[model samples]
Target: MGSVTTKKHQNGLDYVEVSTDLCQARIFLQGAQIDQFTPTGKAPLLWVSAADDYQVGNGIRGGIPVCWPWFGMSGNGGFPQHGFARTRLWSLDSINMHDEIVDLIFSLKLTEQDRQYWPHDTEVKVLFTLSDTLSVSIVNKNNANYPVSLTQALHTYLPINDIHQLSATGFDGSKYIEFGEGPYQQPNDKVNFDKETDRVYTDLSPVQHLHTPTGIIEVSRENSQSAVLWNPWIEKSTRLSRFKADDYLTMVCLEAANVLDDKVTLSPGETHTLTTHIRWV
Candidate 1:
C-alpha cells in the first residue's frame, strides 16, 4: 500500500510526497514535475541539480520539466524559452492508489496572460504513475473550434556515473539535426558523449537504452516520433542557470519530444497524449 502527503520544500514550493511498498517519489505542484523517483531498493532513476534555487518563477534545472505549447526558443525574442508551462503552478486534481501503485493527476490553469503567448482554448494535464517503474503522460485537449499547434517534450534528466563512460542505443538509423548543424544520419549504433551534444532525432525507435556505469536504464515513449538528446558538457554548463559546471559529468537528458516535423496539430476537440515510461533493467 502507498500513502500520499503534501509537504512544503525548504525552497517554499509545495510537493506531493509518495511512499509505497515499491517506490518513493516527489511531485512538485510547480511545473507538475517529478524531481525525485527511486524504486525501493534501486538507485535513483532521475537527477536534479544541486545548484537549483527552486524559485517560483525559474524553472528547475533537473528532474522532468514539462515543455509545453512550444519547445526551445519560440523565435519571438519576447517569448520565454521552452514556453511557460514549466513556470506555472498546476493543481493536483486526483490521486488514486492501486495496491503499490499511485496515480496522480495534475491540471494546469490557462490564464489570460498565457493567451498572449498562445491564443487557443486548450486544456492540459499530466498524469504520473509511481510504482516499480515510473510512467508519465501529458494530455492536451483542444477546446477551441479551430485547430491548434503544439510542440512539447518531457525533458528528463537521467543520472549517470560518468558521461564519458555512458553509451546509448536506439538511434542507429534515425535522422538527427544538431544545433546549427546538418540533418545527418547517425552512422554509429551507439551514441557516446564526449563533447557538447544537442540533437533532435526524428524517425526514431520508441525504446532507448542508456548503459551507465551504475546500471541500464530503459526509456520508452508513446505517441511521439521525435526525441532530443542533450548534454551541456563543459563549456555550456557554466552558463546554464541553476546548474553546476560539473553537473554535465553526472547527468544527461534523453527527452521524449514532439518537435520538428513530428510537431502536433490538433483538430478541434481532439486530444493528444504523450507518454514515457522509465525503468531500471
Candidate 2:
C-alpha cells in the first residue's frame, strides 16, 4: 500500500505527494491536477513546464488541468477561459490506500466567488489512482433543477524526449477538426508533430500509443468520444504566459474530451464521469 501526506510546497501552494513501491506522484489542490507521475523503473509520464507560475489563482502551465462545464473559449461573453474549476482551490476529500494502488479524491463546489461565472449549484470531484500506471476519473454532479449542456476535457500534458521524435498511432481514418477549421477527415495513417498542431479527433479508439525517442506511451480511456491533440510550436509558445518559447519541444497534449456535437448534458441530480489511463511502455 502507498502512503499520502499533505505539505506546503516551495511555491507556497499545498499539495499531496504519494509514494508507493510501484511509483511516486504529486497532486495539487489547485484543479486537483496530477503534476507528476513516475513509475519505479520508468521515466515520468506527466510533465509540467519549468516556466510555470506556481502562484495561487494562476493556472499551472502543465500536467492535467481539468477543463470543465466548458472548454477553450466558452463562447459566452465575460466567462473565464476553460471554466473556473482549474484556477480555484479544491478540497482534499479523502485518501484511501489499497494493495497495488493509491487513491486520492478531491472535490470543488460553488462558492461566493463562483457566483459571477456559474451561479447554479454544481460539484466537481476528481479521483486519481496511482500504481505502476496512472488513472484519473472526473465526476460532475449537478444540483440545479434544470439540465446544463457543456463540454469538458482532461487536459493532459505528456513528457517527451523530443517533440520532433514523437508520433501517435490509432488516429488514422479518424475524423478531426483543426482548432479554427471545420471538420475534416484524416488522411494520414499516423499523426506526427512538425509545426504547431491543434486538432480534435472524434470517435476515438480505446487505446493510443505515443511514440517518443525515450519510450512508447500508452494512453487509454473510458467513456470518451473526443481526443484533442495540441502542441503549440515556436510561434505560439513565445506568446504563451508562464511557458518558455521552446517548451513545446518537450511536451505534447493528448486530451480525453467530449466536445463539439459530443457535449454532455446532465439533468438535476445527475452525475457524469470521464476516465483516462496512462502509462509508459
Candidate 3:
C-alpha cells in the first residue's frame, strides 16, 4: 500500500508527494508537473535541474511540464511560451491507492484571466498513475459552443549516464523538421547526439527506446503522432533558465507532443486525451 500527502516547498509552492511499495514520486500542483519518480530500487527515471528555484509562477526545470493550449511561442507575441497552464495552480482532485499502485488526479479549470491568453472554454485534468512504472495522461474537454484548436506536449526530461553513450531508436523512417528547417526523413536506425538537436518528428512509432549506458528506458505514447527530441548540448544550455551549462550532457527531452499538422481540434462538447507511459526495460 501507499500514502499521498501535500507538502509545501520553501519557495511557497504546494505539491503532492507519493510513497508506495513500488515507487515514490513528487508532483507540483502549480503545473501539475511531476519533478521526480523512482522505482523502489532504481535510480530516478526523470531528470530535473539542480538550479530550479521552485518559485511561484515559474515552470520547474524538469520532469514532465504539461504544455497545453499551445507549445513554444504563441505567434501572437508577448504571451508566455508554452501557454499559462503550467504557471497556474491546479486542484488536487483525488488520490486512490490500488495495492502497490497510486493514482493522483489534478485538475485545472480555465479562469477569466486564462481566457485572455487562450480564448477557450475548456477543462483540463492530468492523471498520474504511479507504480513500478509511471503513466501520465492529460485530458481536455471543450465546454464552449464553438470548436477549438491547440497544440500540446508532455515535455519529459529523461536522465542519462552520458550523452555520448546514448542512442535513441524508433524514429527511423519518420519525417522530422529540425528547428523549422527541412522536413527530412530520418535515415539512421538510431539517433546519437553530438550537437544541439531540436527535432519535431511526425508519423513515428508510438514506442521509443532510450539506450543509456546503464540500461534501456522504454517510452510509449498514446493519442500522439508528433514527438520532440531535444538536447541543448553546450551553448544553448548556458542561456536556459534554471538549467546549468553542462546539464545537457546528463539530460535529454523526448516529449510526446501534438505539433504542426498533428495539433488537436475539438468541436463543441468534444474531448481529447494524450498519454505517455515510461519505464525501465
User: Which candidate comes out best when scored by lDDT?
Assistant: 1
Show the colliding residue pairs in model 3. none
Residue-level lDDT of model 2, residues 170-234, one tens digit each, is: 78667888967968888775888889999988877778899998889999878787889999999
Model 2 weakest lDDT span, ten residues long: 113-122
Compute each candidate's TM-score over C-alphas.
0.98, 0.96, 0.98
**Model 1, 96: alpha-carbon shift in Å?**
0.3
> Residue-wise lDDT of candidate 1 within 1-281, one digit each (tens)?
57899999898999999999999999999999999999999999999999998988877899999999899999987998899999999999999999789999999988889989988899999999999999999899999999999899999999988999999998878989998687898897789998999999999999999999989999999999999999999999999988999999999999999999999899999999999999999
| Per-residue error (Å), model 3, residue 202 | 0.3
**Cα lDDT over the full model 3:** 0.92
lDDT of 3 at 201: 93
Tens digits of per-residue lDDT for model 3, 18-78: 9988999999999999999999999899999999999898999999999988999999868
TM-score of 3: 0.98
Model 3 misplaced regions, further than 4 Å:
none
Sorted on TM-score, best first, the list reads 1, 3, 2
Clashes of each: 0, 0, 0
User: How much is the lDDT of residue 146 in candidate 1?
Assistant: 94
Relative to the true structure, candidate 2 reaches a TM of 0.96
